[model samples]
Target: MNQYLISIYQPDGPTPEPEILEPIMRDVEAVNAELREAGAWVFAGGLFPPSTSTVLRLKDSEVLTTDGPYVEGKEHLGGFTVIRAADLDEALAWGEKVARAITLPVEVRPLQHGACQ
Candidate 1:
């Protein structure tokens, strides 16, 4: 099985009201459950906002730490799921389920051999 990253991106802004977000969370959880049942789920998590991110880089032979995302964008990675699939088509099928659940864009990419081993 190949591992794939399913990235969930959300607009950079305030979170939606509970009334609008609660159902979406429920749907996402449902999809997660399905993945787990299929033994496809490796790991999944939701991230804090970009403001909570810290960028680290090597500069002038020194490590520099910068607050916020590495790059500013209208959308940022809000969450992700790592799954094991037979191939790209299988991974994309799972990605489609997540996108439908969250009503947002999802990016699916394969992991390199022995990655995270």
Candidate 2:
């Protein structure tokens, strides 16, 4: 089986209030449960906001570290799931479920060689 990354994207700003966010969290939990039950879950997690990210770049043997994400954009990866599936189609099917559960955009990509595939 091949491994896929299901990346969740959200606006790069504050999240909704707890009252508005609880349902989303519940849905996320349900999705995780479903994935586990289906034997498709390898790993899953929510990430801190982009502001918490640290970017490190190496050029000509010099390392440069930055305080925020590598890219300055309105949309950021909010979280991700690594799943093992039979093929790209199966991976995309899981991604659709994730998007529906979280009510957000989900990007599904196959892992390249040396990337735990």
Candidate 3:
């Protein structure tokens, strides 16, 4: 099986109120559980807002560190799940479920080298 990354993107702004977010989170967890049951789950996690990111760049042969995301965008990667899938079609199938659960755009991409440690 190949490993895939299911990337979840969210708008750049304050999170929704609990009433709006709680159900979404519940659905996300449900998907996570399903992945575990299927033996496809590798790892998954949510991220803090992009504002908290620290970017590093190689400039003039020196590493330059900057606060905040590498790029400013209306949306940022808010979370991700790494899973094992038989192929692209299977990975996309899981990505669809995650997108539905979060009500956001999700990207399903295969890992280039191999599975994660």
lDDT against the true structure, per candidate, is 0.97, 0.90, 0.94
Candidate 2 lDDT, tens digit per residue, 67-92? 98898999999999999889999999
Residue-pair clashes per candidate? 0, 0, 0
Whose TM-score is higher: candidate 1's or candidate 2's?
Answer: 1
C-alpha TM-score for every candidate: 0.97, 0.92, 0.96
Task: Give lDDT tens digits, candidate 1, residues 6-116.
Answer: 999999889999999999999999999999999999999999999999999999999999999999999999999999999999999999999999999999999998997
TM-score of 1: 0.97
Better of 2 and 3 by TM-score: 3
Once model 3 is optimally superposed onto the true structure by TM-score, how far is the C-alpha of residue 43 displaced, in angstroms?
A: 0.4
Alpha-carbon lDDT of model 2 = 0.90
Where model 3 places Cα greater than 4 Å from the true spot, the runs are none
Candidate with better lDDT, 2 vs 3: 3
Candidate 1 off by > 4 Å: none
Indicate the worst ten consecutive residues by lDDT in candidate 1.
108-117
- Candidate number of the best TM-score: 1
